[model samples]
Target: MSYAIGSVSSQDLWTRLKEQFSTVSRTSIFQMKSNLQTIKKRSDNVSQYLQKIKEARDYLSAAMVHFADEDIVILALIGLPPEYNTFQCMIRGRENVISLKEFRSQLLAEERIVETHVPNPLLSAMVADHSSATKGSTSPFQNNSSPSSFFSGGNRQFNHTKQKGRGKFNQGVKFNRQS
Candidate 1:
């Protein structure tokens, strides 16, 4: 080791050894960055997602790639699933930037809310029935006076409505008809 380093002292040799062992390649850095960008919150809780981000961020930091708290927040937001779009928008539209701790707390709260409100079948059915009943009377096709109306002349066969719920927030109710 000293032969290669040209008569380096023990401390210098130790430092050189540490540098050699700890050096990260550009490819490694790029790969870590890519992983950071693509790591998503699918089927994982907020804690898991945050842990992954922290790991990637720590790797980048070890490689001497620094990210500001704002950048970290943005990257974390990008890693979230499509369901978090509204939350992402809310964070982005904030007049004052929040700290990483605040962001984590907010994200965890939102995640909990999302988890709690997921598809209560009984409530969903009630909402669907209510919406359908309201729509039934107000449907333009229900006007028997209109020549183009399918409900005219008691032709109720063509007035069928199919309800399919995907159970994702406001999109939980779907109405389909076969013509």
Candidate 2:
């Protein structure tokens, strides 16, 4: 240790060591910023996305680029995929500026709602003409019920059969054409 100190001053040695082992670099900061901008929820849950945002924010802070809470919130929203487009619009349209805590809570709540949503199978039930099925005659709107039902024909009685494994009971929806 004495021999090493005789060759170099402590200040010069410290500087050399710091130069070689420093964690902060211009390229790393730029990459962190780029990562923050391009991050998406994708397969990650709301909590995981938030954690990534926090990590990037922390990295920026460590690099001496301090960001406000609102800026972080905006960055998080920007990183979200198009699936959250309506939610993003709603948040942006609010009269009062939302805080980071409030935004996180709201986002988590929305994520839970999206995850729990079970599509109603009744909406896509097939419409079979009661008359055609009884008398063995093919009708214009028989076998399928699509959005085009509105333009198909006049008012008719049709049986709504739920697709197999979708539901057990069959229901009826009145098909009405508007003038």
Candidate 3:
């Protein structure tokens, strides 16, 4: 320890000591910022994800680097998985900025909604039936049978007759063609 201290000049020793004690290293700050930017909510719930973000923000704060609530909110939103797209959009489209507290509450509520959601059996069956019915056909209207056969019903033929002077505009018109 004495040798190490003696190697540094007295004039530079105080300055080095002050820098070490008073300042956060640039690399440490960069690492913390990177962590904040790339944080993901892959399998975590809303509360866990929010807690991670809060921890990162707190670390930055301890280093004397502070982020606005809006910035933190944005970071949190961006970290969310695709499942939260609608919720994320709702939060982003708000006219007024959302406070962190409000954001947390809203996220928890949304999480509960998502967790408690149940797929309707009838709806699921309908979807499955529709998909199976249309699996081999490119267009819904496409069929293996002929158009005439498909629409066969009632009368097979129609009688055509032209009437003269059927309307005010046709009063002066004459029908010369036979049907």
Best by lDDT: 3
> Between 1 and 3, whose lDDT is larger?
3
Worst 10 residues of 2 by lDDT: 124-133
Total clashes for model 1:
0
Assess the local accuracy of residue 55 in candidate 1 as a C-alpha lDDT between 0 and 100: 85
- Look at candidate 3 and give me any clashing residue pairs: none
lDDT of 3 at 107: 91
Give, for candidate 3, the lowest lDDT window spanning 10 residues.
150-159
Q: Runs in model 1 with CA error above 4 Å?
A: 1-17, 120-179
Name the weakest run of 10 consecutive residues (lDDT summed) in model 1: 150-159
Q: Relative to the true structure, how large is the alpha-carbon lDDT of every model?
A: 0.77, 0.74, 0.78
* Residue-wise C-alpha lDDT for candidate 1, range 85-112, written one tens digit per residue: 8899999999998899999999999998
Q: How close is candidate 2 to the true structure, as a TM-score?
A: 0.56
Clash count, one per candidate: 0, 0, 0
lDDT of 2: 0.74
